[model samples]
Target: MDLLIDSFVSAILLVVSLDAEMIAIVGVSIKVSLTSTLFASIIGIPLGFAIAFGDAPGKRWMITILNTLLALPTVVIGLFVYTFISRRGVFGPFDLLYTQRAIIIGQLILIIPVVTAFTISAISRIDERYRKTAMTLGADRIQTAWVVFREARFGIGAAVIAAFGRVISEVGISMMLGGNIRGFTRTMTTAMALEYDKGSFTLAIALGLVLLSFSFGMNMLFHFFQGRSRL
Candidate 1:
């Protein structure tokens, strides 16, 4: 108990001191997570909207596959990306393995499914009457999709937040794809894992505090959107 208390106190001091290494890791984490989330959102949102509104053959199967991919294991994603980027693989000439880009790619894969699945669910919940009304008013397919998306904006925002939350906290992809190289691809979750293995709890605790704050902020934003939707 005393050790734990001491670790917590040290963590507070470290954060207060703005420890350079800690700050760097946190910055890298934020940059990678935000970049990957942005990319995932750009790709996933449109795909979600398409799947939600389009009547193409095998659409149901595609959605089911996407839903299943939403639960894909992080380690599996790491391994898959690792194989593609490794020396023996086709893209190996570029040497993307064990870099920030590698980590971002792994994280993007991890979160895309999250963003897509949530987006689909959000669009699915919009009232069918709204769609029928829009079509009746001469709104073409594109306009109808826009109307549904506008109505479902808050829910879509929630999906984005959820994707960010998942990728920011994940360790497997970061560790495997990034090699957790200090001063390079190291991130909060990976740093915490390394520190824990080294029995250095101070940095881990500090990063955990930051992660907790991020999660709280996301939840608060989600609630704000939820409240607005209700209003």
Candidate 2:
């Protein structure tokens, strides 16, 4: 127990001293996660809105598929992307494997379903009366969609925040696609895993602290939106 206590103290001191390596890893993690989340939001939000509001025959099946994908394992996505980026694959000429971009791609795949699923739920929760009222005012389909979207903005914000939270903490895609290259593609989660494997707690604890703080901040933002929607 003494050793554990010493490690915790040392970790705190390292964090306070602003360890460069730790900071870099955290920065990479944030960059990759945020980039991927942004792309996911761009694609997922519109796709989800279309699925929920469009008149396609397979809308129910699509939503069901997306909901199932929400629980997809990170490693599965990593493997799936790895195959496509590998030398034998069609897109392998780009040499994207083991790069930060590769990790971003993997993370994007991991979060798209999450964003879409949450978006559907959020949009669905908006009162149907809003859509009815817009239609009664002689609004076109596009205009009604716009009105409904505006009313559900808070909920959509929550969906995005939730997607960010998921991507930030994921390690499988980061490690597998990024190769966990130190000072390059390494991220907080991957760094934590590497540090723990090396029996070092300083970097791991520091990254853990950062991840926890980020998750808490996202939760607070989500809660803020929920509160605003209630008003």
Candidate 3:
């Protein structure tokens, strides 16, 4: 259709021009996603390793809960976090609502389960003999854990990549918690949503193209690491 073609061309021009608003939205998206992913990895990776290697009772239940949370809706996470941070809510005194920190918190919650589940799966797939072998070689508990983590590094990396993908493209948490304030909290996803709602498809299409390209690159890296893991 002519409209589609025009929109596509306009989007390309917008991207090529590095429009200020577009750049700002993209920057915010990357900042929030990377921050949340880092926090999620910091907490989730260790939690996964602990659950996988430790003899904690009811670990099955813990893992089951985490796995179940992988399917949790983004809006649900946004709503849950908003409840605590919003005015008149439990932690309302902190005034976290509608801020980058609030968006990060929601996104952190969203990706924690993803990273933890993937990490657990990754570590669980490693041969049990590795642990026994490490112990036989006089590796202490800490050293053995380190060895296990090294063996599963690729999978853990994949988990991180996946978490990045999820948080970067998600709109609900960013919109709900960040309030989509232009030049402040607005991100690519939220901007795209706003543009689409306003029937301004050019910018939305541009953001989509950028987001898709980014996700594709991440997937390629994920597959590369996954393939390398087998070697």
lDDT leader = 3
lDDT tens digits by residue: candidate 1, 62-174: 88999899888999999999899999988999999999999999999999988898888888888899899999999998898889999989988988898888988999999
What are the Cα lDDT values of the candidates? Answer: 0.91, 0.89, 0.94
Each prediction's number of clashing residue pairs: 0, 0, 0
Residues 4-54, model 2: lDDT tens digits: 788778878878888998889888988888899999999999988887777
| Residue pairs of candidate 3 with colliding backbone atoms | none
- Ranked by TM-score, the better of candidates 2 and 3 is 3
- Write down the RMSD of candidate 1 (Cα, Å): 1.3
Per-residue alpha-carbon lDDT of model 3 for 1-231, expressed as tens digits? 998999999999999999998999999999999999999999999999999989999999999999899999999999999899999889999989989999999999999999999999889988999999999999999999999999999999999999999999999999999999999999999999999999999999999999999999999989977876676
- Give the lDDT ranking, best first: 3, 1, 2
- The C-alpha stretches of model 2 lying farther than 4 A from their native spots are none
